[model samples]
Target: MIQHSLDALARFSAPDDDQLKALHNSIISLSTEGCGPRECRALLNVFERFPDHDGDGLFSSIVHLLEPCTGYETMLIKSVGPASVPFNALMSDRLLNSGVTEVGGQSLMALLAAAKAHH
Candidate 1:
């Protein structure tokens, strides 16, 4: 499932506009069946491709798609609650070093802030 999502994302990011539309449509189909954390991670990977990827209303749209399907807030609470220091540290490490920073740090920070706000 995640592989499918990644393929779609790659197509969406390709130079061909028609391929982008097809990939977007495929993503829509996947989202309709209800996505999960894996799908969210895949989408996040795609969103990290550009410094401005999180801008232009794309990040919000991704979060909106993920929030409902993933039950993200509840999962966050359930996964580690508020007191899991190790979990937070690991998450912070992953988020900070996530590939997005190779292009620009600020956008990644903004994305992190947005994700936290969503939570």
Candidate 2:
């Protein structure tokens, strides 16, 4: 999991320094054992920012981080439930209105559709 997480972070080749710093800080703040449940729950809020990502690489990185986990089904569902709302909003705002460039190779609507399909 840690290896995957590191790989996920690496996908964001040149993230904004401040955003990267905040993400790093948040990751470090999570107690692997002491507050595992709470940290897991917090992932929902964190992933919600993915759709609003202005950086292609960073968007891919966030998608990789949110990839479906085998035994972590409960955590995954909980995380996606809250994240879906803002994520969908972002998609609608960008894809249905603004002419913002797609992230990496996928459009906002396509990404959201894929995410919903995964769920």
Candidate 3:
């Protein structure tokens, strides 16, 4: 299902809102049904390439959905950028509360890099 949506996404040079929404729905559905590594990677790939046309809301929603899945913190951290204010806030909150670990460290560094890039 996700692969089909992803293929559809790839076909478009500039996807319309409906296309984006379709991909979004597919990701959400797959995540809820237990997103595995392959599914996570595909979803992350979508995030990596696709622009969040509906403000940052779409990206934020996907991030929130995927955050608890485990084994993908590094990828998720790397996916965030300064443009998504909601993601920055979420990462900041996570950093403040999360103990010093590899994932936390990566999130902090990604946030710093994004801040630097933004400025």
Best by lDDT: 3
Worst 10 residues of 3 by lDDT: 47-56
lDDT of 2 by residue, 1-119 (tens): 44443443334344478657655644443323222333344444444544455343443333333333222224433333324654334433443464744544445555456656765
Error of 2 at 102 (Å): 32
Q: Which stretches of candidate 3 lie over 4 Å from their true place?
A: 2-15, 51-56, 77-97, 104-107, 114-119
Model 3 clash pairs are: none
Q: Name the candidate, 1 or 2, with the larger lDDT value.
A: 1
What does the lDDT read for residue 42 in candidate 1? Answer: 59
Which pairs clash (backbone N, Cα, C closer than 3 Å) in model 2? none
Q: Model 2 compared with the native: what TM-score?
A: 0.36
**How close to the true structure is residue 93 of candidate 2, measured as C-alpha lDDT?**
44
* Weakest lDDT window of 10 consecutive positions for candidate 2: 64-73
| Cα lDDT listed for each candidate | 0.48, 0.43, 0.57
For every candidate in turn, the CA RMSD to the true structure comes to 11.8, 11.9, 4.2
Candidate 3 lDDT over 6-92, as tens digits, reads 564355334467765675676667665766666666656655455444323566666665667666666655556554344443554
